[model samples]
Target: MRVEDAPEAWEVVSSTERFKGRVFDVVTDGVRMPGDEVADRDYVRHVGAVAVVALDADDRVLMIRQYRHPVRRLLWELPAGLRDVEGEPLAETAARELAEEAGHRAATWHTLVDLLTSPGMTDERIRVFLARDLTPIPEEENGFVPRHEEIGMPVEWVPLPDAVEHALMGMIHNAPAVAGILAAYAASVEGFTGLRPADAPEA
Candidate 1:
């Protein structure tokens, strides 16, 4: 299942963590490359994450507006979360994030897209799921209090086509959100018969 364009081009000789953070770690790797070349590559090692492109029966996409301090902008994005829970399945991560962030659950789920957030900078992979047939869960029933950045986040339901237009028009800058909306729109154009299983292996 190797991608023809992504051949293994380097062999790692050693790896050392330069800095460890709550979310990710910076690592320096000594590698041997073709033509007897050796080099040190510094990059981020991430725990990965999942996002949900949740659509209701009316075909509106659920989105959240949250301020990203690093980027210094408020972004409208699909519900997403880090894969911090060890041994959690990817689909389960998506479902949990949907509930925790958007307070919704879906009866139908399918894998929409998998993305390597930044190939040269981080080994962070994200799985985006198409979630349909949604039911909202009240905060009293979920018993999960939104904190930190999640506090006071604004949630909205935008028409899917409008979302797709926003994503394509650069209004949605978050990588997973843009990709998820475009993927969902493309799937809809195909009558949604081409979506992969929720647990499909990453390509």
Candidate 2:
């Protein structure tokens, strides 16, 4: 048998929106189980997100430190953003985030990995892209103004090997960043021959 993740939908007897927030919504669903028992499952409804592992020609990955309030700590994370725009391509979202947050754009892009991001608790999904051929965006041409935790965020270029080590050492706590860094490292071992196109279909 092939090893794969197959999709199946249990019958949802009823669903109710429990709360609506700026970034995501909480919902409760009454689902019918295999034994005919109905149970209420609470999960977050998310709009999804995209992240970029921007690798420069020197093999350094673009990184930024931002204060994540919920965790009450500053975290090193990849350039990322919510999928808030309607009908925008995922690659475009990734590019926009990279330029706005990291002040760079990529000439080459590939799908490095797809993540569920705590599927048991939230329906949040993220696409991590491997971006290369980076060119810094001139300050005058970039108009994005950082606010809140993003304000005064420090951007750094860390060697890919160092990044992988940091993640393994529990220094990089951001989920997508850890996954992307590891995935990028694995792909690079094969000269990135098996990476999917930037516009690959979402899992």
Task: Write down the worst ten-residue block by lDDT for model 1.
Answer: 2-11
Sliding window of 10 residues with minimal summed lDDT for model 2: 3-12
lDDT of 1 by residue, 1-203 (tens): 96554636578989999999989999999899778688899999999999999999888999999999999999999999999999888999999999989999999999999899998989999999999999999778787688999999899999999998998788999999999998999999887899999999875
The lDDT leader among the candidates is 2
lDDT by residue (4-122, candidate 2, tens digit) is 77788999999999999989999999999988999999999999999999999899999999999889999999999999999999999999999999999999999999999998989
Clashes of 1: 0
- Model 2 C-alpha RMSD vs. true structure (Å) is 0.7
For model 1, how big is the CA root-mean-square deviation? 1.9
TM-score of 2: 0.98
Clashes of 2: 0
